[model samples]
Target chain A: MDLDLDAATLDFRGEVRGWLAEHVPRPGLPSMDTAEGFAAHREWEATLARARLSVVTWPREYTGREASLVQWLVFEEEYYAAGAPGRVSQNGIFMLAPTLFAHGTAEQRDRILPAMARGEQVWAQAWSEPEAGSDIAALRSRAERTDGGWLLSGQKTWSSRAAFADRAFGLFRSDPSSSRHHGLTYFMIDLRADGVTVRPIPQLDGEPGFAEIFLDEVFVPDADVIGEPGNGWRVAMTTANNERGLSLRSPGRFLAAADRLVDLWRQRGEPEWAAERVADAWIGARAYQLYTYGTATRLAEGGQLGPESSVNKLYWSHLDLGLHETALDLLGADGELAGPWTDGYLFALAGPIYGGTDQIQRNTIAERLLGLPREAR
Target chain B: MRFTPSPEQRQFAASLHDLLSGADTPGAVRAWAEGRPEPGLKLWRDLADLGVTALRVPEECDGLGAGLTDLVIAFEVLGYHAVPGPLAESVAVAPALLGDGERLRALAAGRLLATVALPPHVPYALDADVAGLVLLVENGAVYRGEPETEPVRSVDAARRLFRVAGTGGALGATDGSAFEAGVLAVAAELLGAGQRLLDEAAAYARQRHQYGRPIGSYQALKHLLADVVTRLELARPLVHGAAVTATARDVSAAKAAAGEAAYLAARAALQVHGAIGYTAEHHLGLWLTRVRALTGAWGGGAYHRARVLAGA
Candidate 1:
């Protein structure tokens, strides 16, 4: 097992490092959840797209450089290490992009991918409804087949970035007779559609981080339907896996935070009581980095991600929470104030709740990874 | 870069697993604790023949000249089967310490056995009665010694500990890297032990029923075992990664993580197995005790944490 970057990866890393060094904002942009900050992050994404750094792993046809997974990870490391702004287009770039690449038709890829890569049409997930959170298959959203398209009616809550996003992608029950997983249709709907309503939901940090999307007979063309009409469940699984895996949360983010945490600790004269906790945060981040490297290596070697994605989700969620918690603890009384650490801590708290809750993740790990008996439904 | 083991490394571990699986390791462990070292020695010789003892030794020293990653793989299997020996010393530590010495060749060839005492934490040599050589490490120096043995009982019966009292000629200055190697090897063992506990607990959870359902179906036990599995799986990358990047900080981080993971697994295993697991008759107790002893073996969590913090 080797950890050293190969020559090509090193070259890619050098290129990314050089580009980020030159282009990363001198003073970092404000929180991407804020309206002004969202615009700034969108501009940053445009800047990255111009350099073909926005979606390094996508094919050149999609305005990308067709980088390898290792290269993408290296790019992410460099991106975070450079203190670059958070990706305002992450819901599009990370969540929907992979699903589009995997299941989208040629026309869909041609239309949606470039817009996503260029940050021209930011996307948000419209998966969870008010009635359906963890049990997404129990969603009551319906998509009635009309003449050449489907008329959708649903209320999706906790739709991240939906407040300002141009489009959303989610599953809608296409057949009235079918329930649970079958007869569901995955659709990419315009948030500005005739019957669409977007209501921003203020997050714990008092920002419109996510929104509630109300779709009342919103028409989506058949071409916007991803995968097969009755195969949305299968299609959505790809997005779900990506959400829990490398796409949404890269180890680079935590490693950078851990580095910041260590710096904070050092600044505090290295209090002996907090030393182990600080050390643990760093070690945990390193473990995650190595673990992601392992996962990337496995994926590169043609291994499919299964329930192990749940394991990755649980690990990173806790790691992020713990890293930020330690940072705040090191901050002492000042931690109570609204600063980077406190803000980050608030965001970290959302990690376990989103992408799927820790409880759901644990259940998945137990049932799928450990071969435990599923509870009686 | 490939962070996972190569096929050959996996095959090596698999073969070791097969051999240990058939060796009646629990019986051997019992015999060792009963002061009958023959069975454990025979098992150790079998492992030695597999070139486990020779892995870290240089090829010029009549050994495999393998890296720490290979030793990590071998040591993991040894821990999985709960193999009884000074494995870290003979397979990892002593090889790095002694290098191409005449005794090193014998040790690699399974002709001789060795134990070590790196005071003040490890002032006692384990299985010293069966060892043909003993090395005492102190203050960056290594010395040959014949210990005046006072038997010290460990929580794990298989570990025959001894307090050494002797002085001898210095062999050479001890390399700090040897200690780090030892820690990494022990970490691998802890990872293995943790895995075994998880496996045993999972199996028991499936079979053992309570309140009209299998205990595994209960969310409490399920979450507990799941957490154990998560910790073990995460600790694995740390151990293997530390093997590749053998820095003091990396090794210490690995040791700390592996130790805590193993300790968690031990606790969870016992809790899942209930009263049966606490009894010595049950094989789960073997790993439980082994995990406890090994958690504080090379350097405890506090020591490794301090090392990581200092290095950070």
Candidate 2:
């Protein structure tokens, strides 16, 4: 239980820290949501990929160091502590890439991963639609088999980065007769194709962070199909689990936010009321960090990811909200002003709503983890 | 760097669970709370035989030379059962404060129950009347003490505190180890109690029907308990991490998190149990009140959060 990193792990941490201290941008690039910010973040990803730092845990053949999970956590801590650029390729690296490793064809990994890692190609998740937000299996997107591929047509809303991303992945009903999860096929579609139209949506902070991706008979090669036809639900679960769990949201981000909050409070005279909140922010992040450490340990011991990922999602989503709220309160009059804390507060508002709402996570935990009676949905 | 408990630690917890399951701990707690410690005393001896008390004592002291991590495993089980007595004092603080003297030997053998009064932090000795040994800790100075007045009643009946007056010169210096151990023990206990409360609440939600369905099926209640589960889940690792490090900051972090988490669990459990949980006869109150009592037993949220800030 001791936090005794071995010599090798310590050396790895030191190397990452040194690299980040040296290569991280002087002033971090803008958020990867707007056009200018998006291009700048993509360039930053190129810088990281050139150094094999863009995807630390990915296989070395795909522009990564093949770092261990523990090292990846260390990399994250150092990365956030340095105030590095936002991961412009996170949709690809964190979400789709894991699914690719788990279910993609060997050729798919070889073709997609390097470009994704290098930011030459960026990916957007087209998981949600107007009617199939949380109930993703109720998607109406359809794919028709073609000579060497499939023709995809769907209106996918809340497709992050789709406005600028080169490609997107989602589930489309392949068999017209099948309803719900049965007939769906996971397919990667080119956002720049002939019939694809992206409508950028302004988020709360008024940034084009999310977009509605409309595909009208968009062409997707058979090579892009993941798993098998009628198996998109299970394949997407691989991505869904990664999105909600340790991969998408690391403890480092919260730890960094908590540290900044503490600094903000101290700079603001540390009001007695907000003092406890400030301290709790730090404690909450530390607990989550320690909790992740436990998760990493279990994964190292040959344990597979289980329903506990929902636990991670539930814990961090609220911690993020509460931490940002405290920071805003510390800002007082300035809280209403548009700044980092305000922006973060707005962004944190969606933590519980995205990556499977905390409500759904609760259902998963109750039924899957606790063995409670399933809800009569 | 591994954070999961060892297999042996897991086995130890299971064994303790088995013993406590059969011990009818709710009855023991009820007896102890009513100022009758006989059943609780028997439970204590049984735990002692299982090496709970001897975990911290040195090998030379005729005890298992185990670490705070091991003590945390034992204390968590003890807390899950809500076992009564001066546990933090006898099992954690005493061995860390005292040398392997007659008193330490007696504690390791479960023949003596100790209570401590560390002024400013722990101003009143819990269960001082029932304990066989009472010590006052002022600054770094330690001394044998006696109760200056009758038992001071707590909201939780088992917590019978007493103001103690030192009877002799400082017996020894506290050396700070005892306080850390005590705080760690209480943190683990709170985590265990929180887990039990969540478990009971979930079970009740499953069986107790309302509006033509089990209450557990309601998203409202499920989300409520889900949040509780997350807190307890995260809090346990903090307790374990504190046990691993034993730093002032780490211990206080554990205490603050576990204290708040367990308190939240108690509130949610009460909410889930509804009216029946409010009754004196319902065993849920035992854990509910115990959580309330132990929240400030070593250091409350405000105090521990302050420590966390100061330490950071």
Candidate 3:
């Protein structure tokens, strides 16, 4: 019946706050707008790694401190409060790392886990081929049988971070004709293969966080396959479920930014409309936090991912985009003058498109959760 | 963290469902409200007998001492049975007027059936006449008043509304949190009504046929039903969250979220029922009527949205 954290959890939060205050890098450490920012953030992560606080939910065997879920949430709250770097290797560590621990073979785990834990290896996703983004089972990449191995040949577009990745985890169709999500295998392929090519795609913000990867006759040893061949569908489903399940972005980040926006507007003594917009933005930010906090509490209690996560994702995306849009709007004509607000607004447009589109999430909720019949596309 | 209702709550909800379904169909409700003429005595007695009117009063005052969660169960049952009365308003708004032991005892005994006498445009004003007094709230102030007009007919045929001319005792200056609580209560009722509509629509679609197949088996109608279910799912958490927050005295965000959930539920219910729902013969229309009344009952969805947008 009560919504407040427990006394012990509150104490834990205070401890985290005090620790973060002492350890967080000083302002001007880096920004998120450029490669230098990304590198600087990596350095910050390495520092946290040294302190054994990064990724608190990972087991102690994985070089983690094995904190409780509540402590994990508290850590995140403090981490975001302290302006820690956004985890650049989230696709690798947050999504794949967990799955590798659970379903991966001993060899696979031995090869992947430590490098991921240490941030020594950067991983990219090869899940979404151009034709296979939403209908992921329809992946066209082929991995044919070869002497003591498999030869891979195909293309994966929107392969996030492929340009900077050392390796990739991908689902490939083992039998070229087995298209309805069967006879496929999940493989870990080295990005430095002789015939591989990675080309960065300029996004709306002209950032190259996205890349198109071409796999041309790349050989992967049989040992690299994580599970039974044809079990790729299951493996990929597990991966996606983990990906969506673990995606936890709180409103604190946006709230911090929005607070800064408000301070800027207020300090400048701008229009009264700007005050109203700031208030509106704050409301949206707080609403999102409440929803996310609810989700976090659920996960802390060992709850599985459900339709409601879509609700959270859908809500936060819309709220984040809305607040940023408001920020841009409040800046008026000057808001479109290529400043922070304008760039943020453009970035917000990608919110609905990334992870999964809002429409797609609704469809998932409808078809999978609500048991709705699929719409003929 | 747990989202499921408790066993006791479930049991009480089941009992309520049985009582309400057996005793308070739409026709029966309308007939009773219109036939009773003992200055609200019969209605009050009936509510007490059903334990409906005594839910929120403290146990020390001969009441059930139940909070918003229990009230929510009662409301869902009431909505399901189309119980036409001030079940929500009396329980939600009466406590605001109970200043001393005498007033508290009267409310606990169901001698008082209070309604929030918000204006015609206010959505939850439909249950006004059953109350001995109507509490009106505006801009975080409370003004207890009498109705300026008789109860106006509502689409649900379960309740009526009236306009209050803004003249009554100042119910003491304090934050209008109670009124906000009432609004959140209406949102809970709306959640129930929306869920009922969704369930009914789903059942009907499963039985109703088109081209020799159940309409629900068709993609178009299935997705429509799914959309309604999604709205129901989304609204459920918001309503529950609001009730939790309301008990904790955190009203602003919950109120806003509840308002949106109720408003969306109403709209989605109407869309699901299509033309049949627009007609009065079907109960879907009745729920829609209730939804419209509830959506505006507090401060209207727009006001709550604005409040929410203003960062409660």
Interface RMSD against the true structure, candidate 1: 0.8
Report the CA-based lDDT of candidate 1 relative to the real structure. 0.89
Q: Order candidates by TM-score, high to low.
A: 1, 2, 3
Candidate 3: Cα lDDT at B272 = 54
- lDDT of candidate 3 at residue B311, scale 0 to 100: 41
Q: What class would a CAPRI assessor give candidate 2's docking?
A: medium
State the lDDT at B160 in candidate 3.
65
Taking all chains together, each candidate's TM-score versus the true structure is 0.98, 0.98, 0.85
Better of 2 and 3 by TM-score: 2
Query: Against the true structure, whose DockQ is highest?
Result: 1
Write candidate 2's Cα lDDT for B1-312 as tens digits: 888899999999999999999998999888887889999999999999998888888878877879999989888988898999899988999887787467777888899888898877788998887899899998898889889668888888877889999888878897798999999999999888988999999999999998898999888888888888888899988899999988898899999999988999999999999999999989999999999999987878899999898877
lDDT of 3 at B298: 61
Candidate 2 segments whose C-alpha is farther than 4 A from its true place: none
Q: Which whole-number lDDT from 0 to 100 does residue B15 have in model 3? A: 71
